[model samples]
Target: MTDVVAFLPGNGHVDARLSFAREKAQRLDVGFELRSVDYGAADSFEALLDSVLEQTSGADLAYATGIGGLVYLALRARGALTDQRAILQGPVLWGLETRTFPKLMRLPLMPRALTLAIARGPIQRRFMRKHFTRPLTPEFQRVFFDGYRDARAFERWFAWLTPRLLRDLEQQLRGRPELLDGLTAWWGGEDHVVGIEELRRTEAALGQPISVREFPSWGHYPMIDEPADWTAEVARALAAPH
Candidate 1:
């Protein structure tokens, strides 16, 4: 099967993003069976990764965003996924350093209940706003709000952000350096969610150079903010020899 699996971000859904990916795949006439994985309702990080692995087991290509990219990398490392090519957009590879969280939220001593409360309350708006460089459209507002209000989803999200996940990711990358092969990274210059320096650190950890495409004007969600550019980039990556 010439399948392509699209992995959504933490607070994301298979709506406009997945539609855009499907549209691009159709436009390219690549005969890809496009599918999207939803992690919003997952109970934990491992559960989310398990769902992703199961969904994309037969995929030949994969597209992932934010933390979803990390999930892809982990699967690739574990030999759970054997996709020939992967397109990672603003992947959260640098662990906690890649994100901009409040000092209180990052504290190891912080209660999970307090963190969940903050995520569901005042911090939700800020968190959503950080993903876009422009104003929120009605559709995105609905998606963001729905995800933010789901307490269980926030718990899963927070669970993925812990230091243990970072350590595990690093070990995986180190153990399976081949995970970085046949991967193209797309990063937004104005992205507030991921740091450039941290990306460099991740590259060093991989011990290989990653092909990266930078969109200076776009934020975290380039597919939503710059669909044409994102599509063209994917097409180019797909067209390239593996």
Candidate 2:
């Protein structure tokens, strides 16, 4: 039996989607606990990392999906987490850094203001939905909507997503290839939120080969899109020898 810790996506808390891990654990007759770092409550990436470390101190393995995967990588790179093996689903590596903005939005003051504006309910909902290749169920809709409505949360998220932070993260990962030694990553070919280019960049930055599984039709949220497949991957990771 293995004790597993699952981290929620960037704007999410522990929710029903994580129940798939619980169910998988039961079937495998292994120990499993789902934990969350409240990204909404964090004032910055440093605070978010602190919360994750504080919350998930004694787990045997880490399971992180979406941006949470990236968070796990950051925590591991910083030596904040002790988990020997990690399962990362749809990790958002260099996507944030490569995001394109309109010429007008690039103007001073307009960028932050426009980001804040889009972080509001209606626009945020539309933007969040764009991450998926297919439509979301009602349950996921509520989850996404709730995340979008938390304006302060978006503020903190944006604040932590600066170019400086990206550079720091790259430097940390490149400087310590051992940080990514036991990671297994899953990526969706259809994922609009994180591109293959980002995955390649992540591999390059790691300075070593990484175990990655690619699903051609899956989108950004594979657990939501295909829970059974996601759970199966988790089980495989759990069963693999570290």
Candidate 3:
């Protein structure tokens, strides 16, 4: 059987990382494909889930990062997880329920455009500076800006930011801990976005044992910071038998 590696990128310009994913698949002597959710076209969370599921169909292994992790959880909830083998890199699977801003943004009184405006402004860079351990590389920064040229996409993503989604996902995983089976999670010890502590909390909340890979020196975006090492590890995983 021909093996394939499907990459589900997070919200942002993922051209470079997508290329790296292809290289990793090549190292495993497998075909490669990218299945990023069309945040712009999806009008509802259901639509977003469908987009991810459709894109990931027929893959031997699926790798998701950031928001992509949420998509996978949603799939598991619906009993439609396409790939039997999957990896989550710094997934935002928890903690949204406790975040006030995302909750406020979803309230009827809040203007949806406000979130998009903030995304396009300096606040995002400020957030990155505060949360990430190091400055974004020039290549990563260029794509970050390029992604904003499409305002509609950001608006769609903002619409799905709600505490209810996180709560529901957590509940689903808690109810069926087996949903997490066959999944391996990767984290950068230095990644402030989803730190080691949050990972622990997620593990506790789910009460499921998740396979983990910790890289002490890496940060949030290992593809930008340590492409060679990151790809090497992913290649090894792809080559290993299930």
Candidate 4:
């Protein structure tokens, strides 16, 4: 499989996460590449991820998380196995009913218009910038906002798709039974977005040869929280030869 599994980044995240992974591959002396979708209104997350992996010569793994991870699982659950393998890092296995969902959008009383308005405005970026462990480096700040600012174009074009992100997630966890078996990552002791108990229960429910670690120190953005340490593990995980 082409070099190694590629990494698909989460929404609006800039270079730090995937770049950290590249450093890991170099240290491990493994053949691998770190690339992510060039975010755009024209490309759905899965379409972009699938295109990247399809260009490879053989089966290869892909590492993805959050909505990004759900995109990969959506394809696998749908029976489109283009990649040789997939490695889910704290995947969005379930629990996305409120984030971006079609059913909720269909609900007459859902305040989606207001939500989208908030997300499209500076309000969302301000909130995002606040959540990071560190302020986004000034350089990333420019590029990050540049892309985020253009999200209105997408909101107009993909209005219906906004809620579907969460629906896609909930389906994989509840409707699809094929998501959990392939690969793994550290669960959590008290994950906020993805709880420790739910993660473990999801793994057990799948009942397959999956590997996971439980770390209380890290949260959802484990790579950002402990890049060097997580990268070391990811490097070894990739070297194992899927």
lDDT of each: 0.65, 0.64, 0.67, 0.53
lDDT per residue (tens digit) for residues 12-131 in model 4: 455554555566657765555555544344355555546644642243556777555555655565556533456666655544433344335455634446454545536656744554
C-alpha TM-score for every candidate: 0.75, 0.76, 0.78, 0.62
**Which 10 residues in a row give candidate 3 its minimum summed lDDT?**
30-39
Candidate number with the higher lDDT (1 or 3):
3
As for TM-score, the candidate ahead, 1 or 3, is: 3
Question: Residue by residue across 1-242, what tens digits does model 2's lDDT show?
Answer: 55656564654344555555556656755545556545546766787788777765676667676566767877877876644677777766666566663234335666457645754667756865777665656565665555444534544554555566667877787767677767778778888876667677777765666788888988877666666666666666667787
Q: Write the per-residue lDDT of candidate 3 for residues 170-191, one digit (tens) a residue.
A: 7767767667667898988878
Report lDDT (Cα) of residue 80, candidate 2. 65
Best lDDT among the predictions, by candidate number:
3
Which of the predicted structures, 3 or 4, would earn the higher TM-score when compared with the native? 3
How many residue-pair clashes does candidate 3 contain?
0
Candidate 4 or 1, higher TM-score = 1
What's the CA RMSD for each of the models? Answer: 4.1, 4.0, 3.7, 5.6
- Please identify which of the two predictions, 1 or 2, would achieve the higher TM-score against the true structure: 2
Cα lDDT over the full model 1: 0.65
Residue 188 of model 1, lDDT score? 83
Candidate order by decreasing lDDT? 3, 1, 2, 4
Native-to-model Cα distance after best TM-score fit, residue 108 in candidate 3, in Å: 7.9
Q: Model 4 — TM-score against the truth?
A: 0.62
Worst 10 residues of 2 by lDDT: 99-108
Q: Which residue pairs in model 3 clash with each other?
A: none
Winner of 2 and 4 under TM-score: 2
Question: How does candidate 2 score on lDDT?
Answer: 0.64
**How far off is residue 153 in model 4, in Å?**
9.6
